[model samples]
Target: MRRIRVAAAQMGPIQKAETREQVVARMIALMDDAAGKGADFIVYPELALTTFFPRWYHADRAEADHWFEAQMPGPQTQPLFDRAREHGMAMSFGYAELTPDGHHFNTSILVDKSGAIIGKYRKIHLPGHDEYDEERAFQHLEKRYFEPGDLGFPVWRMLGGIFGMCICNDRRWPETYRVMGLQGVEMVVLGFNTPSVNSQKGEEGIEQRMFHHRLSLQAGAYQNATWVVAVAKAGSEDGHHLMGGTMIVDPDGFIVAQLGHEDDGVLVHDCDLDATRFGKETIFDFARHRRIAHYGLITGRVGAEPPPEE
Candidate 1:
């Protein structure tokens, strides 16, 4: 049946004072928990190693750089790899990546059951502005700290299926899934760190934000005919409240498993990859139903003149 038992490893907030060791220990505990539940794979949230730091503006580059990791399996993160190896579990997680060239990006990586790195994806659609504005409740300076991802949407063949990865803000965009969908992706793993309140839309309610989050994930899963594992790092972190709505969506747009806690928890589901065949071969068979010629405007030109009236 090509079934995979997946776990949405939703994490509680990481306090600003917490060390990397403490965070990694929390992740390992979750890994062990998932393994005990017979989960073959686990998905962790964005910036899983530390607090969401973009909320505060940093004038010094070094101070900001401290939040990023220079290497994936560096000393601080090696234990995660070891835990995955010990459990023979495949996993995906997000982190702040600092390149040797002095560039930084919001990155996520996939690891095989053997704990070998499968592939990586840098977040393309970075949210928030680079400059801080005094009018907002809190700063969301993602653009200020990380460069736009250079790596395009890529998919990999692993665990008896095609897999793809995306980060927090990337999940809100349809193009993020469509690109991987074109590659015949069977599963998509995404992690997010979303605030309960929108600083830009101050009047927006939390219910609306949660709706949008689930709507995007369901839409992406159903439209692409792929299973989606979306995890969250939520709750109050350093007094800032974030949303917690971790879930696993089936190819039919149904949320099979979900988390209802604002604390560290794991939600496991046995997902049948074969279930995607029906949608892909019938309703969402892109190769048979897609018309690309008319889509030139999507990439060719922006704000082009409209067609003349009849």
Candidate 2:
């Protein structure tokens, strides 16, 4: 198996009170730590720049996108790229993208060792209710704030390996990984800002939080035979507590690296890209096992009307 070293940069959120410049500095520090630890690439969690703002309802769209970065490699974040270039480190990070085309998305950017933008992934799975639910504990206004990702699942070759990115909720879906797996992706880098409690579902505290986190990543890794590096903006920020437990899974689904406390930290792992080849050629071989011909309904349209009365 060909090897590639990686670091999962796990940290808690920047409270709504904090500024973007301060958060970007924090991210740079994490990149330095990962590079200091001999890692070739570092992965940071979603919305790493600001507090999880979608929890509270906002009437103005501009205010909602205030935390979103209008452009990549723009002001306040160029330092991260420059530092990565100087240190010969590559990084993957998730952020709220305020696209110039007039859409906002929870997106991830892949940067190579030379600080080149290799790829960008817009989150496809958007969670939370469209309107505020008063009975719930906390509000999740992601659907209210962001448009669903327009870009379908994509895999990119960079930093000496093939990689893919998906935000937190997207990990819950199997097709998220299957699509990239079909492309022979060797690794997947993803981030999340998941709260420790689920307000909308009306369940016990913390029951499904960790379960969904680990289960999704594990199954994705095992089923697709790819390395999964999932970092989280964990710990209690503001009044709410976000789940911590940042982790990395190997090609065979083993939890190779994990962070316990969720405070700003890094988990370094030696990942072998070649390890995935064995699985792709054997158990999960798409060329030999995928029966696309039988799954017609996947492409079939389930019309609500009776075929226009034909």
Candidate 3:
């Protein structure tokens, strides 16, 4: 069976004021760390370029623009590409994207060892409020600031295997993995910035939130029989606490590598992509087990729980 080495880079808070150069430098350092350990691929947290700005109350367009990156290989982040190319390593990082047509999105990019941009995935699941709710302590205005991800979940041929990507909230949905699984994806990369508490519920939310995080990843990996590499940009940012549980899950629903803290850290795992076959053939074999019909949830149109009536 063949294997691939992967690194899940867990990083602490990044100040919104931090320049692109600073963020890129941080990413390069992680890349170097992974490369030194002979990792073939590195995965960084969602919005790895800047602080979690969706938490703040912002009315100014300019300020919002300041926090968004216009072009990926543009001036500020070119060094990241140059460095990865020089090291002959592949990487995936998440960021806020300002599209050429004036659309703003939460997005992630995949770069090959040659530094060529292989694929881009816009986050599909936009969480939080569309309108300001001053009653809450903090804001999760992702829906208010950014447009819903236009590009549906997609899989690509990369790094000698089938690859796919998803953002924080997207990873929570089973369909996110199913989309890629249909393509016979061998590996999935995801980045997250999950908060420590649910704004409405409070501390009881912690266990459930953390459970959902691991649950989705584990279930997704096991169901799809694909390697799951999940990284986090965790810790307190803007006076709000966040959760950090970076982990690498094998196709068999087992955690191969994990990091406990929400800080600057790297967890490396020697992944056998071929190991996916063991689960795929035995447990998650779609051709042998998946029932496409009789499950009314998938093809339903309204997405509103099917009217609650049989």
Candidate 4:
């Protein structure tokens, strides 16, 4: 039995005024807690170091560049790597990436037990509009701030299991998992910063939003026959609330462990990678069940084309 003690570290909101140093301190605290709980693998939420700045719009996009990380383990984040190495823990987390070439992406990385980054994933399914819209209750300018990920869904072998990474909105799309699932990924780790209420429709409150959140993760895990660790950066970020529903879902889509609130906390669980074999070899065996011929429309078209109105 290949068992990985995983920790989902859910962080509270980081207000705009908080520095990366302050945030890293908080993350270290959570990491310490996970270590105490005997967790060798921990996951932190998306944009784990800063406020959800995309909620505000800027006439000059470059003004937001300060929020992007030019280097992964650059000064401020080095401590995280050091602590992971000290504890022999593998870690995954999300942040905004600014490449030296000037490309920006919503990115996540997988660090091995020795603190070496083994894999990186840029979020592909970027949600929200590029331009500021008067209709939105709040701005979500992800498209304006980041380029659609050029790197496709990729998987790696680690911790005696196949691992994959995705970020925030990428988790909402089935394609994100299937692509890695095709590679026989045994586990998928992700981080998200989701608003508690729908910016488009306030009536769609936390209940509905959380429902969709769990629905997406659960479906992705069960369908792919993989374990899923979803961490959230949630709470009132300068008055705008983010729903923190950090959880660990098993291969059967059951939530084995979940954070009870939107606060700085850790939920640790022992995930058996072998638990995935039954479903994968039987019901979800893509090699035997996937019919690609009929899926042309999935890749061939950008938008859904309705069959003749009949």
Residues 1-310, model 3: lDDT tens digits: 6767888888898876777889888888888998899888889999999899888766764467778888888898899899888888888999999988888999999989999988999998899987779877678989877888888878888777889999999988998999899889999999999888888666656678888888999999999999999999988776778898899999988888899777788899988888888877877788888888866667575456445756
lDDT of 4 by residue, 1-310 (tens): 9999999999999999999999999999999999999998999999998999898899999999999999989999999999999999999999999999999999999999999999999989989998999999999999999999998999999999999999999889999999999999999999999998888998999999999999999999999999999999999999999998899999999999898888899999999999999999999988899899999988999997788976
Best by TM-score: 4
- Which runs of model 3 end up more than 4 angstroms from their true locations? 60-62, 305-310
Give per-residue CA lDDT, model 1, range 138-248, as digits (tens).
889999998889989999998899999999888888888999999999999999999999997887757999999999999999999999999999999999999999999
- Worst ten in a row by lDDT for model 2: 301-310
Write one digit per residue (lDDT tens) for candidate 2, span 1-310.
Answer: 5677898999876787988888888988888888888989989998887788888887676778678898889888899899999989889898888877879888899999999998999888899977888888889889988889989989998866889998999998998999999988999999998888778665645657787778889999999999999999987788878888689988788888898886898999899898888888899999999899897765586444355654
Error of 1 at 61 (Å): 2.9
What residue runs in model 2 are displaced by over 4 Å at the alpha carbon? 299-310
Model 2 scores a C-alpha lDDT of: 0.87
For candidate 1, the lDDT comes to 0.93
lDDT of each: 0.93, 0.87, 0.87, 0.94
Error of 2 at 91 (Å): 0.6
RMSD of every candidate to native, in Å, equals: 1.6, 3.1, 1.7, 0.8
TM-score for each predicted model, relative to the true structure: 0.97, 0.94, 0.95, 0.98
The better-scoring model by lDDT among 1 and 3 is 1
Select the stronger candidate by TM-score from 2 and 4: 4
